[model samples]
Target: MTDNKRFLLRRRPEGAPVETDFELVSDAIPAPPAGGFVLHNHFASLDPAQRGWMDDAPSYMPPIALDDPVRATTVGQVHASDHPDYAPGDWVMGLNAIEEYSVVVPDGFTAKVDVSAVDSPSRFLSAFGAVGLTAYFGLLEVAKPQPGETVLVSGAAGAVGSVVGQIAKIHGCRTVGIAGGPDKCARLVERYGYDAAVDYRGKSAEQLADAIREVTPDGANIVFENVGGTVFDAELMNLAKHARIVLCGLISEYNSETKHGARNLWQVLAQEATLHGYLISAYVDRFAEGGAQMAKWIASGEVVMDEDIQHGIDNAYPAFMRLFSGANTGKLILALD
Candidate 1:
């Protein structure tokens, strides 16, 4: 058998991920076991959480073992099958490694999408994958938002944050998004139905805080916190009484050499604000319920799944880095042959 190409985690990183930390190596596609199959990978997801996976630290999900193919959620069509449940031509989604093809150890992969309905199978890797599910459960369950409350979402134009703001809107909240630039801010309001949007570039922390507060003078009642660090501190000081802060992603601090802490936590105590950090994987039990709801929203056009897909799998590292640069307007994906 000839070898195939895969990106392996060469070593743990000191901070931000660099291409050198990952080595692209050729490896063989192992033969499927009695109940397994091979999927011709087409699209692989690039998520901010991948950064956390690169570190050798405790997290909701275990770190990717060194020298192993970097972990990712991927969408592909099965070309060979030995499992009764999944046959040839089946489009499935699951936690797959970074490679052109994958050997599915039957019962190892969870079928998330049929692929036929979406037309574009990559949607499964975006809206219906971890990114979409994360937004759904994080906002609906963790925030437990009420109608008419102001909900502010950081990383507002990205995959999870984009969905979070829209879900808040569906619940009848006044949605505000904080993105990085004018284009993203525009998309947040124009494309995703955010009530307002703020660009945080070239602004002081106080100015950013004021900008966010101006839209919800009484203070935000619900905040879908994605980018932490200074932004977290700013949001903490502007919480409404009994506000719910759903800690989703901390992309801003993900690549920092030293962990950053918020000093304004005292505000939470004073305002009686509730801050809850969630890992979507922990809510796998609710995936069916949440996926059903998201699908309904998608069908009804209440929620939109905006994706930013790059052309090749070799671009995975750059796609992953885009999250920190605020280069993606929605879910970032890498397409393979």
Candidate 2:
């Protein structure tokens, strides 16, 4: 057997994760057990959710135990298998880890994929993967948007938020995005078909609220919030009567110790609005339904998704940090070579 490289969690993160928190170690590659397969991982999907799993806290999922590989969604080819459905060299996608190889079973999220459906296999990690699925289900199901309503999205340039804006537009809702910089804000309107884009960088809570109100004079009818903390607080202040707020992610507070959630949740009660906490896992059974429609949207040019792919498992730490640094424009992927 050869060596399988893995980036394991050496210690829990303090504030933001650093290189020292992880250790890259090589272990002997083992054969697949009964009803399981060995996957030769090609791409690992980097996400903000991984940061939440790093902490030893009670959450929607269990924390990543020390000395274990950092959990992530991966795409690869079947290297060896005992399962009847899997064959050597067959392409697959599943919830694995940041490793060159993984032992996989036919979990609900694991399945063989048709590589010809996408331009590249890594596209499965971006546009057609979990983030895209999150946008599809979270908006259409949880937010329950209406035509002609104004939809405001925070973290609008991100993987999930970017897709949310386009889906909102497809549903006939007027889309406005709130991103951090001028460049990202521009893409929200130009690339993602948002009606307007609000630059949230260097703005106070009141200032952000004023900006949002300027675009949406009557206030936003639907707020798809990805960034929590102050951004969420601002959105609360600018909600229209009976607005729907879909809480998909709290990216701003993901790395921080002192997590100050949306401070103005009372706005929900005041405006008689609905604030929904969205979890993509709830819609896992409907992935095929969402994936089919999303593929159609991509084929018709109604929706576009971007990816920033980086090479090598050695560069995992810096690559993961790009999510928080606002450096990556879209889905961040790490390819092991």
Q: Write the per-residue lDDT of candidate 1 for residues 196-237, one digit (tens) a residue.
A: 998888877788888878887899998898999877777877
TM-score of 1: 0.95
Q: What TM-score against the true fold does each predicted structure earn?
A: 0.95, 0.98
**What are the per-residue Cα lDDT tens digits for candidate 2 across 199-266?**
98999999999998899898998898888988889899998999988988888998899988979989
Taken over the whole model, the C-alpha lDDT of each candidate is 0.83, 0.91
The reply for model 2, stretches above 4 Å from the true place, is none
- By summed lDDT, the worst window of 10 consecutive residues in model 1 runs over 106-115
C-alpha lDDT of residue 114 in model 1: 69
